[model samples]
Target chain A: MKYATMRIISGAGERTLATITEVRSIAALFLHALHGCFRPSRALSASFFAQISRQILYTGVEAMGLVGIIAFFCGVTIVLQSMTTMPQFGVTEYFGNILVVAVVREMGPFFTSLVVIGRSGAALAAHIGTMRVNKEIDALEVMGIDPVHFVVVPALAGMTLSMICLNCYFDMIAIVGGLVIANVTVQVPFGIFLGKVLDALSWIDIVLSSSKGLVFGAVIAVVSCWYGMAVNNIRAVPQAAIRAVVGSMTVTIILNIVATVGFYAR
Target chain B: MPVKLEIDGIFWSAGVFPLLRGISLTVERGEIMVIGGRSGCGKSILLEICAGLKRPERGRIVWDDIDIATMSRNELLTARQRIGYVFQQYALIANYSIFENIALPLRSRGDLAEKEIDVRVHTVMEEVALFNVEKHFPESLSNGQLRAAALARALVTDPEMLFLDEPVSGLDPQTASGIRAVLHARQRRRERTIVTICHDLYLWASRPHRVAVLEGGKLVEPEENHAFRQMVEARR
Candidate 1:
């Protein structure tokens, strides 16, 4: 039993070290890719622009419906739960504020990032991992092209741009869902619900939420790119995908927490 | 101008396993040298090291009197820009059309107008005997056509030097000969220095200027270049 316990501990320590190494590599790749973009030749290339457009279409345009549906349902559920529980506590007057704060500040960024992590982050890792194993990265290097410039920058730009737009859209639609619930179930006027939500929301909320979306998008791109370029075998591709998704999601959640506390901690 | 390339006492290893030991060679301007070896004999590794994609553990690769190993990042990029490398697997971007793949090197320079890029790429395509397949992706190409496209991409920039790894190893005889003919024509026309890694020796109907063999982790010149030249001169 003692031997087994020691083995488990050792394994966990090795895993922790490996995770740190991975994070360092991802951060390095992110910085290098950003540096690559500062060179006008790389940043202004038709290939780079084309890659950005494709990524936008994939991560932003294709995922719009999924983000909307999830946001609307999330809003409706929160409103319903608050309506039932808050009235018993006689705090129902604060429901509009609760919904506005939660949906706009938290749910909007969290849900949109989760969608991109699942849909695009995994795909990014898998694609890059396959290319690494196949010597495509080596091919690029020999051709005097940095793979980071060709692969990661566009992904970074696409995810950030998409997430910011999607978060705003999610917030808007989610409020509509809450207004719908307010009008039909609670017998409140649509104008009242809209006015209350608008009152509770501030430019600060948009700024905070947009910043969260941008940071989360960058996290996903860097983590995905790092894992993807780390593969050496066929088995490693699936492993890379899993790690990329988990790492990006973890980073996003941690960033969300810190941002939340930093904004509200008075 | 075609620059002189020198590989001086290069040593490389894979973990504890030594792959290349004290391998040295000199490739003169406007000449072709084919390095032949068995499987896993570090043929590709040597090519990659010479291309500046991989650094040798111990040795200096002097390209036109500048040691590539000590060059800065931008210097390395500048050096690589003057050379073209063709991988055995073609390595064409699967999502890109043939025209785009061929135009990639030119596009990366960021100075060529679209018309210049189109003209140079099409001219190289014609040189490689590839026509009307510009819109097709790499996945849709035949083995021979893919090899042609790879060669076209390598030559489209009019690089001063060209390196190919197992370029014709997997193609049919007719297609293999066709590729060889195109390579020879390009070399003669452009005076581009060429280094090829080959597994099969029987296919060299038009033998290169020199033949070097990688064996026992060292590059050995067969003295065939001198002997073959003498024999040809004797015949003439």
Candidate 2:
């Protein structure tokens, strides 16, 4: 019994130590990426900017069609649910307020982030993991190139910029979808629905939603890249990609909840 | 400036299996040292440790009397800039074209303009006898072409020290001889130190200043015992 108790304690200690090491490593990686951003390295030549542009092209521009389709369907569903049920309770006049709060303040940033986490986050992790297995990262180190500066910084900057822009794009598409669905389903005029949405929307709501996108982007990039860098062999690439997706989604949801509570709890 | 490498009392292990046990060796400036051993006998691991690519569990690796273990990350990178390395597997970036792969070191240094980089990369490619494949990526290249590209990248910087792992493996006899000639000419033109790991002994018989055998996790000089003669005869 005593020996078993000792083994249990030892296992717990090892797990705690591993967790601490993981957190410290992630924090160090984040700081290095930030430093590369502010002061910049000599490697930040035209090629560096080209890398950032390429990342933006992959994570932002290429993902537009998917984000647009998802946003439109979500908008239509939300508006249909609200318009059909809200009038029976005599709260139809507050339709504008409900739509703005639900779509702009909450759903816009959240759903867009989920899409990015699924697509870009998994891809980033898999790419880096494959590089590590092939010893390409070591090759870069041998050439006196900082992988964090050359790889992670561009990814971080591009993902953040993409998230902010995609959030805005998602908001516009969803509202348009809502307007069309409202007019077609309930015979409500498009102008009145749009006017209500515009009236209920505030600059604060836009700022807060954009802020959530920014944070979510940084979190996804850091976590995915961290998992990618941790891979040591070929077998770990798919595992790292899966872990990156799950980790990014979990963190994004928790942060979304925190942002909502922090902003409105007062 | 030429640098002398000194490795002392190195101990390394993988998962409780000791691969190198208190191994030590040194190579002077401008010397060619070839380490030979059977496959999976930790020859590559020792070369990697000497090149500062992997840290040993206990030892000091010094370049020109400066201990590499004490150097900061940037300082270590600065030191590594004076060194060139070629991996056994090529390890070329999949996304980069051949020209970009060869020019990466120069681009990272950021001292020379694009014109100088282009000139230097072309020169090295020519020296390696690789032509007209500059725009192609690694995936499209043959094994010989890939090896040539990797060697060209290593030599583009004109480094003072070169650490090559099986640089001539998997090539025909003529291609292998050509690679050896290129390395010999480069070393003769400039006082460059080279440490190579190869299992093929006859390939490097006439070139290296010294040949050492790694067996039983210890490095032994060629003249130390009968095992050296046995290794050479085995290769023959």
Candidate 3:
């Protein structure tokens, strides 16, 4: 009985140790990639520029349609649901506040991250993982090149830039969709709805939403890169992608939780 | 300027198997050293260790008296910049064009101007007898062409010590001869130190200055290619 108990305890300890090691490695890679951005020689390399442009196009611009459809439906449904429910509490004027908090401050960045992770994060992991398996990373190291600088920084920068832009686009489309729904059903005046949205949004709200976008973007990039480059063989490539997607999702939700507690606690 | 590489008391293992045991050798400046043995004899691992890409469990790789095992990351990188390693698989980035591939090492060093990169790459390309495929992708090039491109990239950096692992293994005889000719010309012209891992005896058209065989995890010094074969058989 003691031996079996000890075995189980050691197994749990081993898993916990693995998780900690993985997280530390990811954080270290993230810092190294960030440092690469400040090194003028590496930052100014043409490869960096090309990779960033490609990543933005692939991750951000290509994700617009899915984000648009989801945002539109989400906005209309939330507003309609609020109109039906909030009248009982006589809090109809708080519709704008609810929308601002739920959509702009939270859903915009969070949903965009989900979509980006599904679409681009997997690809990034698979691509880098394939490179690792092919010994291309080894080749770079042998040639005196830092793979994180050459490979990871551009992905990190591009995803962050794209997330910020996509969040804004998501918010704009969701508002337009909500306004259309309002005009069609309860005949809320376009000017009144617009005024309410504007009134509900403080600079702090905008800053918080944008912060979510930036942090979530960096999280996805770093997580994907860390998992991708960790792959050692062809069989491990798909596993890396799955691990990256899960890791990115975890980081995104964790950041969201922290932001929520931080803002609401005060 | 040529470089000296000394592999001293090298010992390495994989899992439960010992791959290298007390292997040691010295490649003098401007000397061409060729290492050979059977498959899985740790020839490639030794090459990687010598290049500081892999650290031995128990040994010191003294590249010009600086123990790479103890060198800082930046120092190791600086040391690697002066040594070029040609992978057996050619290992070119499939995403980059041939021109870009050849220009990679110089570009990564971040010291050469674009014009200088272009000139150096083109010169090496000519020397390797590869032409007019600068914009072509690696997949489009023939195997021999890809090997030539890999060699060109290695040489474009003007590394003092060149390490080629099975560089001419998959090439036709004529192409292999051409590759050997370029290596010979470069060795004499630049006085570069070279270490090659080869499987084919015919690939050594221009005999290396020193030939050694790796068997039973030790460097077996052979007087000639014929003797190298005897050493391999003796170990097996």
Candidate 4:
């Protein structure tokens, strides 16, 4: 019995090692393809212009109104709730810092990733998955064009740039809307609220927020493309899209936690 | 134009099923070789091996004295540029305009100027009679148009050898015949070395200078059109 158990354990260990090696190799291939896609010298000016046009249409223009409404209401609600509670401790002055940290560093990246994942990530996965099912990827291979370079790179570049821009937009709207709410609803002077915002804001905070957004964008792009490529049939497209969004959101939140700890610890 | 493809004892498997077992074949320049078999007979696998997409477990694919199985990825890519592949599904990039789809391979070469690419693309599109539909997307195209667009893209680079995977399947009889006619015309015009996979024995009989029948993971004999058809019918 002891020898049999030992053999079984050894077999399982070998299987685990093989799985790990396969996963590592696939990860390395994905990273290499991503690197090729993002290399600046490979960017054709015409293709870049075309990608910018698509990004504006898909990410920026399509997402602006929804993000604007969400940010505005989020700011107002946070301020209203904070005012009701902070007066007990007379730490109402800390409201600006709380709002900035919560909204800018945490909520901003998280919400934007969620929105983009729902909108662009699903679309990207479905598009690419359909292309894969149709053998367009094989066609690219036959033509000697690396599908990663031609299809995936533009998407990563566009989404990363767009996510950063959206976060900035969200940040601007939320802070301004919070100031308005504090002035109108809480009877705080507009000048005092503005002064608090300016004082509480730091370059480090902006960098952290932008970094979070960048990571979220990368996660969404990579997960979407990975799932898209894995899809083999037409029926698998919707499931791949759903997986991309859910996977991106989950990774985004986890990464946010890690980033927050690292940023504050620094 | 003297392109030679020699596959020597190629062995392939999909997770130990052994799709192609020690398959060896050769196609000389200016010859049309039709790989005919029922579905799942590994004709596509053989074509993929020749295209360098599937590496044989233990064999060499030599193209004009160079073993493609041993080439570096970039070298394999360069070698692939000299071969045209028409996928069964007419794999035109959906998001791109037909012009852009044809232009994709040209852009990858990174050696051609934009002007040269445009000229080559236009010439090939004209050859395939797809010039008028260049602005349309693949999603908007009819089945015949899609196949033509795919063919135009395949032929754009003027590959020395062309591989067609079920080029006439899933089309109306009239449309399939028309595509076969176009393929025959193109072959005659260029005398290109072409390897096509098809189940339609009638179409295969009409065009191929040689026919290879794959059955049960083994390539059967005759390596000629008439004798191969006789063998196929006798088996049936």
Candidate 5:
């Protein structure tokens, strides 16, 4: 009994240490990538910027349609549900407040991040994992190319920018969907709905949403790239992709909860 | 003679099995050192350690008197720029075309204009006899072409020290001879220090190089081997 208890305790301790080590590694990689992005002395070459632009094109521009559809449906469902249910409580005037709280402050960044993680995060991890397996990363290092500066920085910058933009776009489209649904179902005046939304929205909501987007983007980029770089063989490529997706989603959701609680906690 | 590269008291292991044990060597400037070992030996790992690619369990890798193990990350990267390495697997970036792969090091240096890079890449390509494959990706190239392309990339920078891992292991005589000629020409032009891992020791008979065979987790002069002596006698 004593030996078994010691073994379990040791295993738990080992796992904790491993998790801490992994987190430290991710933080170091993130800081290095951030330094590369902002350092003018290491001014991004035209080619490097082109890489960043390509990442944005894939992660942001290409994701617009899916985000639009999801956001619209989400907004319609929430508004319809509110219209039907809130009248019982005589809280109809709070529709705009509900919409602002749910769509802008929370759902916009969270759902968009999920989409990005599903679409780009997995792909980034697989791409980088394949590069690692093929010794391409070693080749770059042998040629004196810092893989962090070359691969991670552009990805980090691009993903962060994409998340910010996509989050904003998602918010707008969902709000539009809400307006359309409200007008069509209950004949709510467009001006009145718009005024209510505007009245309830504040700069803090916008800042919080954008902040979530930025943090989630960095989380996905760092996590995906970290898993990818950790890959050692071809068999690990798909595993890396799966781990990246899971890791990105886990971290993003955790950050989402923390951000929400930190700002809104009473 | 001044030492250009030194490996001192190197030790490495994979899992529970130790691979290299207390291996040490010194290569003088402008000299070629060939490391030979059978399959599964730690020759490539030793070369990688010497090139600062993989850290050994216990060792000092000094390049031009600067201990690589002690250098900062950026310092090590900058130091690596003066060294070139050709992997046994011909590790060309799959997403890049042959021209782009050859031009990557130069582009990363951010020193030369595109035209100069173009000229240099083309020149090295010609030296390696890789023609009409500039736009081809690694997946599209044949084995010989891939090897030559890898060699071209390593040589394009004109690094002071070259580390080649099985540079000519799986090449036809023509391709292998062409590669040898390119290395010879480079050596003739400038006395670049080279360290190579080759399984076939017979290939080095025609060239002036020092051979060290890795066996039992240690390096020994090839002259002490019976097979080497028989090969030498047969040649005579």
Candidate 6:
């Protein structure tokens, strides 16, 4: 029994090591491909443009309706919650600033990344996973075109650009809705609320939030592509795609926390 | 034509199960070499190994005296450009238009001008008689059209060797015959070496310069045309 237990433990250790090695290799492949994208290759350029168009369609246009509705409701809810609390503090005028800081600086990029992970990220994984399973990656290699240059670079470029654009749209709508809500519900003057928001909104906040958006976009694209390429079985593609989305969302939230702390640490 | 490919003592496996065990074969340029076996007989695996898509556990695949098994990944890729592969499911990029699908390899080549790419794509599409459907996506195409588009994509590179995996597996007889005719025509025109996996013995026997039989992941004896037919008929 002692011998058997040791054998089992050793087997498990070896399996874990193999998994870690595979993950490391995949991460290396992603970074290598990321660098390869900027190396002035003609194949990479065509794929990059193709991916940019796809990203615009998948991440920006498809997301507008959902983001718009969510932003409106978020504004409305923040106003309702603030009206109840601000009266207690006698600082009802600060509602617009609060909404702008919460929604624009924090919530907008976070929720947009979440939505994209669910929609476009999952689709990207599924599409690429299917390609891998069907030996299209091998086909690309056979044609002397790196799959990273042809497939992955374009996707990363497109998603990064799209995420930034989507977050910008989300911020605009949420802030406008918040101002309208403050005017109607709190009876705060719209001009005063707008002035406070503009004063309170820092360029640092926008830059940090957009930077986070870009990082999250890269994480989502890389994770999905890695999962897609790593899967061997056709039935495993969906599971890999789901894992990519869930893993990316969880990592994004954690990174968001770290970024928030780092930004406000001073 | 001279022998352009030689496989010596190839060994491959799918996980724990050995797929190709000490398999060896050779193909001369302009020859059609048919590998006939029942499903799961490792014929496709052999083709993939030959095409440098799969690495073997042991053995050497020499293409014109170059040992492909020992080449670097990029070198293997460059070697692959000289070989065309027609996948079992046609494997046309579904999102791309038929023309774009054919144009993909050329774009990757980075050698052809836009006009030249267009001309090559058009000529190949015409050769496969798929010029009329060039603008359509793979989803819009029928099985026959899809296979032809795939063939056109494979042929556009002007590969010296073509590897086909069950090219007519799921097609209707009419469509299958049409594909075979297109392949036959191309063979007549270019004299390219063709390596194909098929269970349809009669179809293969009619065209092949040589036939190899694989059973239980091992090549059986007597690899001549007459012996191959007799063995297939005996199995039937």
Model no. 3, DockQ: 0.57
lDDT of 3 by residue, B55-90 (tens): 899989998888888889877777788988899888
Query: lDDT by residue for model 2 over A128-202, one digit each (tens)?
Result: 999898878888889888889887888888899999999999999999898889889888898889888999999
Fnat, model by model in order, equals: 0.43, 0.62, 0.55, 0.60, 0.70, 0.45
What docking grade does candidate 3 earn? medium
State every prediction's TM-score relative to the real structure.
0.92, 0.96, 0.95, 0.88, 0.94, 0.90
What tens-digit string does per-residue lDDT give for candidate 3 at A35-91? 887773552379888879999999999999999999999889878998899999988
Cα lDDT for residue A103, candidate 4: 87
- lDDT preference between candidates 1 and 5, better one: 5
Model 1 bad stretches (over 4 Å): A1-18, A38-44, B222-236
Worst 10 residues of 1 chain B by lDDT: B223-232
Off-target runs (Cα >4 Å) in candidate 4 are A1-30, A37-45, B170-178, B222-236
> What TM-score, to 2 decimal places, does chain A of model 4 have?
0.87
The local distance difference test score of model 5 is: 0.90
Q: Alpha-carbon error at A154 in model 2, in Å?
A: 1.1
Each candidate's DockQ: 0.50, 0.73, 0.57, 0.59, 0.63, 0.55
Docking outcome class, model 2:
medium
Q: What lDDT is obtained when candidate 1 is compared to the true structure? A: 0.86
After superposition, candidate 3 runs with Cα above 4 Å error: A42-44, B222-236
Q: Which model, 3 or 6, shows the larger lDDT? A: 3
How far residue A246's Cα lies from its native spot in candidate 2, in Å, is 1.9
- Candidate 6 residue-wise lDDT, B62-97, digit = tens: 998999877887787667778888988777776778
Give TM-score values for chain A, per-prediction: 0.92, 0.94, 0.97, 0.87, 0.96, 0.89
Per-residue lDDT over A85-181 for candidate 6, one digit per residue giving the tens place of the 0 to 100 score: 8879988667767887788779988989998899888888888889888777877776777787777777787888888888888887887787788
Model 5 fnat?
Answer: 0.70
